[model samples]
Structures are given as structure tokens and as C-alpha cells.
Target: MGLILTEDQLILRDMAKSFFDEKSPVERMRALRDSRDAVGFSRDLWKEMGELGWIGILFPESVGGADMGYGELGVVLGECGRVLAPEPFMSTVLLGGNAILLGGNEPLQKELLPDVCSGNRILSLAFQERGRFAPYAIETKAKRDGDHYTITGRKSFVLDGHVADQIVVAARTAGSSGEREGLSLFVVEADAPGLTIHRDDLVDGRNGAHLVLENVAVDGARVLGTVDAGADVLDAVFNRATVGLCAEMVGSFEEAFERTLEYLKTREQFGVKIGTFQALRHRIANLFAEMEFTRSIVRDAQTAIDEGRNDIAEATSAAKARCSEVAPLIAGEAVQMHGGIGMTDEEEIGLFFKRLKAAELSLGDAIFHRNRFAHLRGY
Candidate 1:
């Protein structure tokens, strides 16, 4: 498998980079946060992105998607990270849309995916229940009636949940919490009765929601895949999302490092450019090396998902673990190198700093992925 981006992929990357630079600059995220926008993102910009065919990069052509691979999708995500784009690619595309694409029946796919591709609808995955990342530790119960299921439970950290038109929920049908079996996936409408959504403002200027499903009923037709075998789908979606998130973190830290480099060149200290200092140069060199290594591993993970390799799980874990570790190091160094300015909210580096910290903990943190990687390797 090739580790480098192909010629076409490089073109796509450059195009996306320029596009985000022009349209979704860092200030856009800051503005969205300060305004306390209810939707938490610009719907018009999202639709423009859909018109550009980015929102549908991964879906099949029959569903109005570009029918591309994760490599292409990763390029877009990396660009989004550079500008701290506040759109819902993670919630609407990676986590929620992938669940439907991977497990939903044809009718379900046709029903929602086209709208998703056009940016007319929004989707989110309501799987996370606790503070940490645990895929199989679901406790939300989905009790079956004759032709429906009554879902009753709570979900926290539901990305963009308050505005999602449809939510893919993971509910336990038989097995207890922490077990892999007896789990199920269902697509519930946002306005469904007995479902209360509480909006939450994330530290990184992103949107989140807490959901309380008290006897929220969904038709059996909304079920994705088999009744008691949703873990298979959840595992696939989480792996893909983890790799995608690593791609975003790679872009975030890369931007942070680049900005720090610019500051070193221009900012003077003791009547001399700090770039001339040996100690800081050494730190820059080390961060550059680490960032390059992170890029390669993330590319490998993206390729593994595209090629359907047997080691996809290992590759994803390695990518996530490396990103989770390196992102903090790079963000911290960027802040330190920027000195007092970085600590203030007005400085752009602080924005990257906060984003990197959040990204480092997302999907699975460094320790969590390290343990997962070890177990997958039979250690």
C-alpha cells in the first residue's frame, strides 16, 4: 500500500486547503462561538460544501455521493481542521452517515442519505453515554413491542444532537452494559415524542447535546442491520471515525506548528530573532519529525480502511495513539514558544491549543488506544 498521496489526491488536498483558507478561516469558528448560534454551524456554508460534492465524498454514486475512499475524505477533514471549521462532518458524515451506509437497509439508505449528501438534513450518533470513550458500554435499553421498539435511556456528548434530523442510537436489547452482544442500532427522529434534547456548548466552540429518551418509540423498520448484531456495525463506524479524527488532529497540530514557526522567524527576542536560538531550533526539529511521522501513520490507517486490510484495526489504533500523543506535545510547544500571547484568548494559537487538546481526547485517548493496540497484538 502506498503511504503517499497520489497525484489526484495531492490536487484534491491543495484544492481543499485553498478552499478552507478562503471560506472557513479560524475567525469563523470564533464568531460562531461568540454569537452562541443555535445551530452551531452555518447551514448555508454546509450546503455550499455539499454543492462542492464534499459532504458526499464517501457514499456510493447512486446516492448522490462522489463514491470516493477515506483518503479523499481525510484530505477534506485535514483542511477543515486547519481552519477549525465548525461544520458537522464528524457527526453527520463519519459517525452517523457511515452507520447507515454500513448497516442500514436499502430503503433507509435511500430515505436519508440523499438528503445528507445535499446538506438538507443533519445526522448524529447518540452512542456515547459516559464521560469517556467506550463503544460497547451502552446501557440505553430498547425494548421491543409488536412492531416497534421503546427506547429508554440517556446519551451524553451527542455531537450536534440538538439539530440532527435523524439520530442513529445504540441501545441494548439483551446483554448488559459492557457486553458486545445483544446491542442494536436504530434511527430515531429528532422530534420523536418522549425525546428531550439539551444543547451543550463545547469548550472548542463546537456543539454537543444530551438526550433523554423516555419511552421514545421507533418503528422496527428503522433498525439498521440485524436485531441483535449491531456491534459489528458500531465497531466498523468507530474505527472509521477514529481514523478520521486522527486525520483532523494531524491538520490541527500541523497548523499550530507552522504558525509557531512563523512566530519564531518574525518575533524578536533580545534584539535578535528567536529562530537563531539553538535550543528552540532543536525543539522545532523534534516537533517537525513527530508531525511527519503522525502524517504517515494516519495515511496508512486511511489506506487500510480503503483497502479493506485485515490489519485495519491495528493501523487505526496506532494512528490514533500516535496522534493523541503528538498533538498535545505540539500544541503545548506552540503555546510555550508563543510565550504570553498564546495564553490569551485573542491569540490564534490558543484556539489551536484548545482544539488539539479536545482532539487528543476524542475517539480514544492515548492510553486507551495503547491498551487496545496491545490487546489486538496478543500482548
Candidate 2:
């Protein structure tokens, strides 16, 4: 099979890379990282990105989305990973955005998609709970009350949950009916009464939160997808999210490899560049080889997803597992190669290492993804 990216997709990726280089340089990233609100996003840059049709690149055109496929979308995310542009693109545009596109009705999409597409509002999928990463193990509950639903639950580790204007919560609407009938998704305003957000400081200084829904009330219209049939919604949203992160890790892997290689070439030891040593050179070369392999696997998953193949679920986990394990290995080595300066905050290598570590742990880490891969194999 030919493994060539379409000309348009390649162009899109280059434009995205150039866009970040021109506007979101290392200086801007550092400035935003040190700010009081390290949600680490630049609204103006987000607006520019949205205007570039990056936010809703995969959204259906009917509801103000570009209707682009995931291959194109993956390219943009890949560029973000390369540059460390600090916007919640994956959490909002990729994860939460996919939930609405797949499970939301036309009216709900019309009501919300425009704001998200325009970068005027951000949305997050509030699914995970404290110490719970599996979407099916929802501790949150929604009780039916005549014409509306009253929700009460707690969700933790929601990416950008603290700052989002809207949140899609996965809660149990019914008991396990022997027929996979326990989960439901509800859209609630972020500022709804009885809703409290507890922001947490993550390792990478990104914005995440613990949400407490104490008698949060909303209209029945907010229920997304078919009631009592949200398992598919979660499946679709999560599979896409997992796959998207794999693509980003590919970018992270490549950039961290190159950065470390740069260090090897310039950083002198024993009167010669450290890279000239056979052992260190071999290590960097192995990492380079792994990065290329990672890119191939992620692209294969992306193509599968775009083609709507069942192979995507299993292959995605495989790719994520490999990347998660390999990315941190690459990042840690990159840091080690820099010696003392790598551990110091003054160097950008430390930041890349920190983010790479964070990315490795997010969504599903190597262990988590391997389990998923095992389950998918039996199916």
C-alpha cells in the first residue's frame, strides 16, 4: 500500500507548523507557562487557529464544522505536539467535540458547535472520576425528574474542565439491565447552579479539575444520544481521543529526538562532541529509529480511523501503548544527555521532558492501553 500523505494534508501540516513558529515561539510558551493561569492557552492564538479552520477540522460541515477527516486533523495535532502550543485542542476539539458530533442531536450541535468552532467557548468531557479512568465505571448518577434530570456526581482529572463553558458528563441513568443499559451522557452549563469546580495543579502546569455536581439540574433536552445507550458514545469519543493522543506522541517523540540529537552535536565532553562517542551515538540512533516506527504506526491508526475500520480500536491501543512506553524513554534520555543543564528550568529540554512524561501518562498509559489491546484482541 502506498503510504503517501495527500498533497493537501501535507500542505495543511506545513501551514500549521509555520503558523506556530511565527506566532507561538518558545518565548510565548514560557511566558504562558509562568502566568498565574497556566491553562497555558493564548486566546488570540486560539482565535487565529480557529480562523484557520483547525478547531473544527474534523467536524461535519453541516453544523459549521469543516467535515475534514482525522488524517488531516492528526496533522494539525502533530504540529502542536512538535511546538508545544499550549491550547486545549485535544481535550476540547478532539475529545469533547467528538462526543457532541457523534451523540448530540442536530439542535444541540447547532446550539454548541458554533461557539466551539469559533473558539468563543471551550467544552470538556467530564467522565473520569477520582482514581477511576474507565469510563464505564461511572460513579456519577442522574435521576429522572418529570421533564428534566437532576445530576449529582464528582468527576476528576478533566482536561480543561475548570475553564470550560460546558461539560458533557457521563453518569448512570439506569441499572445494569443485563443489556448494557447503565450509562448516559448529559450536557450541562459550566456555571449551572449547584455545580462546583475544583482546579488541580498538574505536573505540566496544565488545567484540570475535580467537579462536584450537587443537585445540578438541567433540562431533559441536554441528554445526548439515545438515553440508556451512551456506551457507544463513550466508545467513539474515547477511541478517537486515544488515537489522537497517539498522533501527538509521534510528534513529541520526533521533536524530543531531534532536540537531544542537537544537544549531542554541540555539548562537548572530553574535548569532543558527545555525539561522536559510539555508545551515545548508538542510543540516539536507536531513538531516532523508534520515532520513525512510531510515526508509521500512528499514521496507520489514523488512516484506519478515517476509514471507519474496526481494526482502529485495537491498532490504536497498540500504537498508544508503544508510544507511551517509548516517549518517556526518549524524553528521559534526552534529559540525561544534557547532563546538569537538562534538569534545570533554564533549559527548554526539561520542559519537553516534562510534557512528554505528562503525555505518556494521560488518556491511557502503556499499561492501560495494553489492557485495552488485549480486550480488543479477544473480540
| Top candidate (lDDT) | 1
- Candidate 2 achieves a global lDDT of 0.82
TM-score of 2: 0.95
lDDT of 1: 0.94
lDDT of 1 at 110: 95
What lDDT score belongs to each candidate, Candidate 1 first?
0.94, 0.82
Q: TM-score: which candidate is best?
A: 1
lDDT of 2 by residue, 1-379 (tens): 2245798988998898899788877667777768756455787788778888888888877766798877888888888888777788877887788888889988999998987887888889988875525557776889999989999988888888878888898888887422347889998899999999988766765778899999899899988887889888888888788878877777776887888898899988899999899989889888888877877877888888888887978878888888898999899999899899889998887777888878887777888889989997995
- Per-residue alpha-carbon lDDT of model 1 for 232-279, expressed as tens digits? 999899899999899889889999999999999999999999999999
Pairs that collide, model 1: none
TM-score of each: 0.98, 0.95
Q: What are the runs in model 2 whose C-alpha is more than 4 Å off?
A: 176-181
Regions more than 4 Å wrong, model 1: none
